[model samples]
Each structure stands twice: as C-alpha cells, then as structure tokens.
Target: MRIISGKYAKRNLFTLKSQKTRPTSDKVKESLFNSLGQFFAGGQVLDLYGGSGALGIEAVSRGCDHAVLNDVSRAAVAIIKKNVALTKEADRFDVTNMPAKVALKVLAQKGRKFDLVFLDPPYAKQQMVKDMTAMKQLDLLNDGALVVAETDDQTDLPAIAGFDLLKEHHLGKTLVRFYRKAAE
Candidate 1:
C-alpha cells in the first residue's frame, strides 16, 4: 500500500504477509482522508487494530502531530515499525504491540487524548461500539474528535450516545463511517 496525500504522498508502505492483517486499499484510504478534510493542521491520532500502521502513518503524513499505532500481533507490529521507519519520522510515532482495549487503558492512564482515531478490527470480530464506549469513559477523545470505523457493509453500527454519526460511505465491500465526539 501507499500513502495517498500530504508530505508522504505516494510513499509505499509494507504490509504483513499473513492473512491476519488487512491493509486499507489505496482508493478507500484516499476517499476516507478526503472526507476527513484531506489533511490536518495539527492533532494527535490513535490507530487501534493498526495493520501495517498505514492509517496512523497516513495521519502523520497529512499533518497530525503524532500517532500511536497498536496491534495485537507481533508480525503486524514488526511490519508497522518497518513502515514507520520508512517515513524517517519515527519520533512522531509510538508503536505498541497489544490488544486494542489494553492499549487504550494504558494511553488513558497516561492522560493521553486523541483528535482522531482509526478503528479497523477484523470484520468478524468488530467491537466498535464497546471500544468507543471505553474511549468515552477514559476521556481519550478531544472535543469534536473524529472516530473513523471501517467495517463490512453487513455490520451495522448504531448511533452511539456520545458520538454523532457524521458520515458514512460504501466502498466495494467495505463500509466507512465517521463519528464526531460531542464537545463536552
């Protein structure tokens, strides 16, 4: 896969060889970023269920200040690290090898917050609502923070209480939804 825009536009990224991780396609990634304003002025990003670190790295490429990429698989983490190193801005990334929930708790303990978040767990094992709820309880989202969820069309995500569904798009078999956390 490759970065779609910003400083690292068109830069190639490495993905895991295993079927355990699925990298976002270039078309879908480009469209998603375009929907989210293409680039950012400055903001922190969290990439949970990080696969190859493409989503988070793309955020940094598009002007987000920093990104924390987390995945449960060692192979995926290794691939993510390699991809981050390719950016030559490794300092802007924090790679964590852990389950999504565990990583969120650790980040919360550190009082970390994010202006953007990408949640793309395995389609069959998506717990997006539960995860978003954890983020809310941990106060990990900044006011108006954007949460992007990638799932299959068959999986329907309901209107979450603390988040407003801003947009939804269907790309092939993939469904992308953007939610804005209420400014509290």
Candidate 2:
C-alpha cells in the first residue's frame, strides 16, 4: 500500500499477507484525510487495532507529532513495526501487542491524551463499541479530539455520550464515521 498524501505522499509502505490484517483502502484514506483538513497537523494520534499501521503513519505524514499503535496480534505488531521503519517513522510511533482495553489503560496511566484516534477493528468483533466505551471511561480523549471509525457498512456504532457524530461516509461496503468530542 502507499501513503495517499502529505510529506509521505506516494511513498510505499509494508504490509503482511495475513487474513487477520486488512489495510484501509486508498480511496477511504484519501477521503478521511481530506475531511481532516488541519486537525491532523501537530496532533497526537492513536491507531487502535492497527493493522499495517497505515492510518497512524498517514497521520504522521500529514504532520501529526506522534502515534501510538495497538493490536492484539503479534503478526500485526510486526507488520506495523516494518511499516513504521519503511516510512522512516520509527521515532514517531510506538507499537503495543495487546487488546485495546489493556493498551487504553496503559496510555491513561501514562497520562497520554490523543487528539485523534482511529478504530477499525474486525467488523464482526464489535470492537468499536468496546473501544469507545473504554476510551470514555478512561478519559483518554482530549477535548475536541476526533475519532475515526471504519466498519462494515452494516455495523451500527452506539451513540457514545461524550462524542458528537461529525460525519459518516459510505464508500461501497466500508463506512467511515467521524466524531468529535463534545464540549464539557
């Protein structure tokens, strides 16, 4: 796969040939970034259930200061490391081989708050619900932070309390839902 824009535009990245890993499509990534506008610049991002580390890497390419990537699979972590190295972004990222909740707890303990968080877990796992819930409970999100969730077009995300749904884009079978934290 390739980075769609920003400093790393058209740059080639690494990916693993595993059934569990599904990289976000270029079209979807492009659309998501375009909508992000200036929000991605100089932000801290979290890529939960990160597959190829594509989303976080893209954020860094667009000027995000740093990204923390978490995945439960060892293979996914390895691929994310390879992709980060391929983009020469090893210094801008961290990879955790653990479930989303575990990673969330660790980040919260570290007092880390992200400006943007990407969630694209396996659709059937109903991971969006659990991850968002944990994020809210842990208060890991920054005020006015953005959350991007990619899921099968059919999956319905819960109406999270602290977040306001910003936009929803349906690109064929995949749906990208954008949300922003509500003012306190």
Candidate 3:
C-alpha cells in the first residue's frame, strides 16, 4: 500500500501477509480523505486498529501534527514501525502493540485527545460502538473530533447520542462512516 496524498504521498507501505489484518484499499483511503477535507491544519490522530499504520500516517502526511498507531499483533506493530520509518518522520508517530481498548485507556490516562480517529478493526470482531462509547467516557476525543469507521457493508453503525453521522459511503463490500462528536 502507499500514502495517497500530502508530503508522504506515494510513499510505499508494507502490510502483513497474514489474514489477521485487512488493510484499507487505496481507493477507499483516497475517497475517505477527500471527504474529510483532504488535509488538516494541525491536530493529533489515533489509528486504533492501526495495522500497517496507513490511515494514521496518511493523516500526518496530510498535515495533522502527530499520530498514534495501535494494534494488538506484534507483526502488525512491526509493520507499522517500518512504515513510519519509511516516512522519515518517526518523531511524529507513536506505535503501540496492544488491544484497542487497552490502548485507549492508556492514552486517556495520559490525557491524550485526538482530532481524528480511524477504526478498522477486524470485521469478525467489530465493536465500534462499544469502543466509541469508551472513548467518549475517557474524554479521549476532542470536541467535534472526527471519527472514521471502516467495516463490512452488513454492519450498520448507528449514530450514538454524542456523535452525529457526517457521511456514509459504500465502496464495494466495504462501508465507511464518518462521525463528528458533538462540541460540548
């Protein structure tokens, strides 16, 4: 896979060959970024199910200040680190090898907050709503934070109380939903 735009545009990224991780396709990534304004002025990003760190890295390339990429697998973590190194901006990234929930709690403890978040957990074990709720409880999301969730078309993600659906699109079998947290 490769970064779609910004400073790191066209940079190559390696993905695990294992079936455990499903990397976002270039088409979806590009379209998603376009929908999110293509670039950021300055803000942090959280790639909760980071995989190869494509989503978070892309955000950084497009101008977000920093990114934290977290995944549960060692192989995925290694791939993320390699991809971050490829950008030659390793200082702008933080990689964690842990479950999504655990990583969220740790970030919350550090008073970390994000302006953007990418959630692409394994389709078989999707817990997006639960995770979003936890993020809300932990105050890990900045007011009006944007959240993008990629999942199978069969999955229907509802608009929770604190978040409003911004956009929803389907690219073949993949469904992408963008939500904006209420500015409280």
Candidate 4:
C-alpha cells in the first residue's frame, strides 16, 4: 500500500508477507484523512497494531511532528521500518516491536502523549473494548487527542471512557470511528 495524500502522497510503503497483518485499504485511509481535515500539523501520533505503518506515515507526511508505530509481530515492525525509510521519514518515526497494551504501558510510563492515535487490531481478537480499557488505565491518551479505530464493521466498539465519540464512518467492510479525549 501507499500514502494517499500529503507531502508523501503516492509514495510507496512496504508490507508484511505474513497473513497475520491486515493493512487498511486506500479508500478507508482516504476517508480517514478527509475526516481529519487539517488537524495533523505538528501533531504527535501513535499507531497501535500498525501493519505497514501506513496510517502513521500518512500522518507524518501530512505535517505531524512525529509518530510511534507499534505492532506485535516482528515482521510487521520490520516492514514499518522499511516503509519509513522508503518514505524518507525515518527521522519522523519510532518503531515499537510489541503488543498494543505493552507499548501503551511503556509509552505512558515515559509520559508520552500524542495528538492522534490509531488502533487497528486483529478483528478476530475482539480486542476493541479490552484495548480501550487498557489505554485508559495506562493514561496513554491526552486531553482532546483524537483516536481513530479501524475494525471490521461487525466488531463492537465500547463506550469511550475518557474520550467522547466524535464521528463514525463506514467504508464498505471497514468501520472507522473517531474519538476525542474529554476536557476536564
């Protein structure tokens, strides 16, 4: 897959050969960035369950200051690194070779905060609710940060705890939901 817009628009990104990783479709990514509008400038982003690092790289290409991509599989992480290098954005990204929850815990402990966060876990895991809960517990989210969750249309998304539902879009079989952290 490749970046659909921004400075890296039409740029190629590497992919994992394994069947375990599922990359987001171009149509879905297009709809996502469209919905995000011009909010990416100088933003810090976190991409959980990042497959090809498309989402994070797209954010950076659109002016996000930096991005952290996390995935459980070594192959996925390797592909993310390669993709970043291919896009000439290696300096704008960090690759975390670990599961979502573990990466969130580590980042949170380091007091890391992001302006945008993307989550696209394996649909078979039914991991939406559990992951959301873990994010809240680890305080990985920041006030007003936008979290985009891409899941199978059938996957149930939980009621966001510290965030408010901003919008939801359905792109064929993919469901993209946006949430913003609530202000105290």
Query: How accurate locally is residue 8 in candidate 4, as Cα lDDT from 0 to 100?
Result: 85
Model with the higher TM-score, candidate 1 or 2: 1
Stretches of candidate 4 exceeding 4 Å from the true structure: 124-126
**Candidate 3 local lDDT, 1-184, one digit each (tens):** 8998999999999999998888999999999999899989999999999999999999999999999999999999999999999999899999999888899999999999999999998853248888888899999999889989999899876667678887899999989998999877
lDDT of each: 0.91, 0.86, 0.92, 0.84
lDDT of 3: 0.92
Give per-residue CA lDDT, model 4, range 70-170, as digits (tens). Answer: 99998888889888887775888999998777888899889998889898888633576677767777777777788888878888766766778898998
TM-score per candidate, chains pooled: 0.97, 0.94, 0.97, 0.93
Q: Residue by residue across 71-157, what tens digits does model 1's lDDT show?
A: 999999999999999899899999999888899999999999999999998853348988999999999999989999999889988
Least accurate stretch of 10 residues (summed lDDT) in model 4?
123-132
Residue 76 CA error for candidate 1 (Å)? 0.2
User: How well does candidate 3 score on lDDT at residue 140?
Assistant: 96
The runs of at least 3 residues in candidate 3 whose Cα sits more than 4 Å from the true structure, single-residue gaps closed, are 123-126
